[model samples]
Target: MLEESIRPDNLALVIVLQACGILAGKEVPVNEKGEKTMALEIGRALHYDLRTFMLEFDNFVCTALLNLYGKCGAMIEAENVFMSFVSLDVVSWSAMLSAYVDQNCGEKALLLYRQMLQEGLQVDAVTSVVVLQACSALAESERTLVIARNTRKTAALEIGRAVHADAYKKQFAYDLAVGNTIINMYGNCGVLSEAEHVFGVLNIRNIVTWNAMIAAYAEQGEDEQALMLFKEMHKHCITADEVTLIFALKASCSMGCLDVCHCLYFDIICAGRETSSLSASLIHAYGRCASLKDATSFLNELSEFHLGSWNACITSYAGEGDCTSSLFLLEEMKLMGIKPDGLTFISVISACSHTGIVVEGAECFMSMSCAFRIVPEGKHYGSIVDLFARAGDFSRVNSLLKSMPMPSDESVWLCLLGACHTHYNVELAKYAFDHALMVQPKHAAAYVALSNVYAYAGIQDAICGPKGTN
Candidate 1:
């Protein structure tokens, strides 16, 4: 139409810009590259035409361009267009704030929000929602850092609370989206009580609200409360989504409540919501409950296999001490062209350790780094140490310990101590015990293991004998 010299009206150009924005907002799949290539091209072309037609300065057109740039991950361009506007509106502020949030630039979004308020711009529900989301994201990021450092600081909690206060002050508390986000922010900050309080006072409770509360409980190890909430959600006749089922199943798994898990599994199957994720959770739940037969049946009945389901089934068998089944599943997974990840090898190696399959365990451990290119973490090394300790191969165990890139942790030393106790090697047992103590000074189990070693050596006099008795 442009080539034919047909001058499109402002509404038609705005529609074209809106279409570009929509295209830019689509999620890109992992396996595909250049997913946004076409969207960016079209957006640029339309933007140029709007400028050429002298429509770029129009507030509506500029806002649309800002939205188009924001959605396309062109925040610099979005900000430029936003600043060029002689008049700023809530929509323009919201578009920029959302772009920052979408790109995970929570700090920038918060700063922009402050600027927006300082300018005395009127805030709308959408603006409030985006700002709250930014606060939530920032709180979550801080919480992650605190958790990583093993600190109990309430910085994230404070920030979230402040955002909650602002939401109420701005009268956005009753907005369902804003309310849900506040609940989620509290949940993410590990303040489950606050999350529950928000949930209790909400005039409207959606599935997301309930799921956030349940997930908060589940994540904090309050599985019983989570399960109870699940029940309450059912009583209210609110349908559970995939997320709700996943969290509920997690709670059931933690409690080892096979009955509850079975009921949930039945509901999922009945509703035909047995997606890969829910299937994986159900398999794990059944496995944790020692209902391996049911877990296996569920795995077999699935028309498609998920890597997670395979890992869960393998882990379940390994936990049951059924090393044969675990290994068989590993072979089957390979035959089905499913690449095994670190967890798969970990489970297989653990199964081998439980069954004293030394050769197979050693091969799997080696294959983890060789074939799979997976760098073994501490848990993998611990498993191998346990394997060698079980087989009374002290020399190989010592060799492996020396070759380990990282320091030996309490579990590795404890495994060695246990092996020493089994073989009645008093000197080695004392060495292992001392190492364990060095790693963790207050390891009561290490002290007990050392005492047992002395008892087994018929050296009862060590503790009760006269002082300085060598």
Candidate 2:
């Protein structure tokens, strides 16, 4: 249309912006040089053209522009667009909050939500859902930060409960979307009782409601409760989806309930769900239950497994300290012409490390590139380093450290530090500790490891000497 020297009216412009918003984050191709024709890029171009034409932005165009910038992850631009508004509307506010959630800025979103309430904008379902999502994300992220702070994940859950109370007072609590998000937030925060309370009061239940509650129980290691909830959902005639089954299986792994595992497995199969994608989960469940016979039986039932499924079973066996079985499965995969990836070797080598099969593990590390032409990544090197470190083979460890092409990072040095503590090598422990601090000055684990090393060495100072010196 522009090539014909024509112009879009305000309605056409609104429609065009809305269409662009739909494809905001997707990487649409605009040229061969691989630049993303993202919604933000397109919207900026259109905005530039409008400015060139000296056209005033109507309310619709302005709002659409904010949505476009937010959805395309241009938060600064989105905030500028939002701040340009003279007054707040719920739609624009919700878009801003949703964009914050998308950017994982949970704290920002919640602050904006509180401000929205102060502005006396009538809360709607969209705003409530967006707020709940912010609560959920804040709950999870705060929990991670709490690991460093050694505090309860109170910030997110407290804010989440506040949101629930506020939204409930506004009569938006019973809305399915808001209710489900409340359940999810509580669940993610590990507040099962609160999550259960929300679940009980929900006027309508869907697969998501049950899944969230079950996942809550499962994630907190409440196996029996999780399984009971799984059974109770069927009583409601709610069919289990893939996510529900995965959570159920996660619970089953710890409880060693083979019967429950089989029941869930058959339910998935009977529902005509594709078993291929779930093969690894099934194998893991059986392996955790310590029922190799059952695991083998399940493997037989599958038509064929891709490389990932085989690796899953191998990893399972390795984790269970069944290194022989892991090695056998590896050979079986080779016979079937399935190439093992770096992950496969990590598990296999770690198993060997635990079992003290040093020579075989060393051979496997050297053979990685020669046999499969797969270059080892840092993780692969870490596994090998761990194998040698745990073996108390300091000569080989020192040799490997010297020969490693990649620069030593905190993990590698910490691996050596751990072994030094275990083997009572004060000198090397001091070296490793210094290297660790040099790599990451504030790593909590590094300090803890240094403390451990000092105690093990019968050295009371717990102070560092110097880098690369005793």
Candidate 3:
């Protein structure tokens, strides 16, 4: 029609722009940016033509342009097109939210979602999907950031629950994509029961659905349940994807089930799905389930040992309370010119704690920042604090707890409470018990531990009061 000089309508332009977005998206995956010169230039030329012809521009056309610009990695252009409209529509807002998520700007996506809701724009399933994706991304990214850089905590899970409530009210929860995203959000938040609710209600299930559910179980430390689902999927004749295998291997690693891991490894090899990451997990599983010799043999069988493999082997040694082996492997890893990451240090400190080697643990903790320039995570702090607490070194424990950069979690406080119970420090026990309740208000274990501390101190009157407040 263009060759014949036939005038194309706005609908025709939207179709072409949508096709361009698809092509550009193909060039760059959702989380990455790459040059899509051909698709980008063609989309720009179309934009020029739309303005030159003074053609009809409506929400459909604007949304199409927004999607094209978003896919081409031109978010500013997409925002301009979106803001050009006086009354924002659901599709336009959804497009921009998607752009933000695709551009790895989850916080921006969430902010825009709130603005859209404030404008009283009712959302559809598409909007719900993108919003949930943003929530999941924010939750995952913040968790990663907290672990990597020791930054602030995330409230994306609360926002996600609100969005989920709205989707349920709007009857958009029935959509498959929306349902899948809901499970993913719950999974990211470590809320397995909610994920299970969404999984049970989904009318149609796919491989992504099963994988999401399995991952949720794995993350929640319900390894047996995760493996059960892995076997259930096989019973349903659903082929396991690489992610499915990976999570299954992780479950096996945690369970220390060598036989199960061998089966999974056989499956991976038979399917020709062996990769470096899978091999790393295999090494980890071998170290956990079998002898260290077996794990070392597997490492030697590989063409090369990546940093992950070393970390896995070292961590497995630490987890098994093989402090000498873990320390030796750390030295070996350094000799190979491989630097240890934060995970490696956590294991090293944990191994030290297991062996009651406070001096070595403190040195490793200090080395995280001074020697390797790596910031300590909450777990690192928790491990070091536990090491000191077990040694009855209350002063160091107090100093570390007070100097913690980030807010303390329940586990860290609980570690202190457990120590106070053993050493019978009434003041420290009260402090830890209060903080534990502050972090996890319903932690019965904290109450029990505090009661033990009180019982040891003969504080019967305090126990008679409301939760030892007296």
Candidate 3 error regions (>4 Å)? 1-82, 86-91, 97-239, 251-256, 270-277, 283-293, 398-407, 434-444, 461-470
lDDT tens readout by residue for model 2, 10-48? 777767878887776565545533233566678888777
Model 1 CA RMSD to the hidden true structure, in angstroms: 7.1
* Candidate 1 per-residue lDDT over residues 1-470, each given as its tens digit: 87899998788888999988787778462222223556767888888898889998888888888777777777677778888988788887888898788766677888888898799886777877787677666655542433542232254456557767876888888688888887777776678888888898998988988998898899889999999999999999999999999999999999999999989988898899878889989999999999999999999988887999999999999999999899899889989998899899889998998799999999999988898789888788888988888888988988998899987678888878787888887777777776777776657888788888888888874432112222
Over 1-470, each residue of candidate 3 has an lDDT whose tens digit, in order, gives 78999888888989889899888977744443544667778888988888876652677787888888888877777778888875677877899999898877778999999999898888888988898888877777743424442221136788888889988998888678888999988888778889999999989999999998999898879999999999999999998988998899889989989888889878877887667788778878887785677677666666665888888888878878888888888888788788899999988998998789889889889988998899888888888988999899999998898799898777887888888888988888888888777776657888888888889878884533225544
Clashing pairs in 2: none
Model 3 TM-score relative to the real fold: 0.63
Please, what is the TM-score per model? 0.71, 0.79, 0.63
Q: Which ten residues in a row have the lowest lDDT in candidate 1?
A: 461-470
lDDT value, residue 453 of candidate 1: 82
Q: What lDDT score belongs to each candidate, Candidate 1 first?
A: 0.82, 0.79, 0.83
lDDT of 3 at 85: 71
Off by over 4 Å in 1: 1-93, 103-123, 142-153, 353-356, 365-470
Q: Which stretches of candidate 2 lie over 4 Å from their true place?
A: 1-74, 80-87, 118-120, 142-152, 275-277, 296-308, 324-342, 358-381, 399-414, 435-470
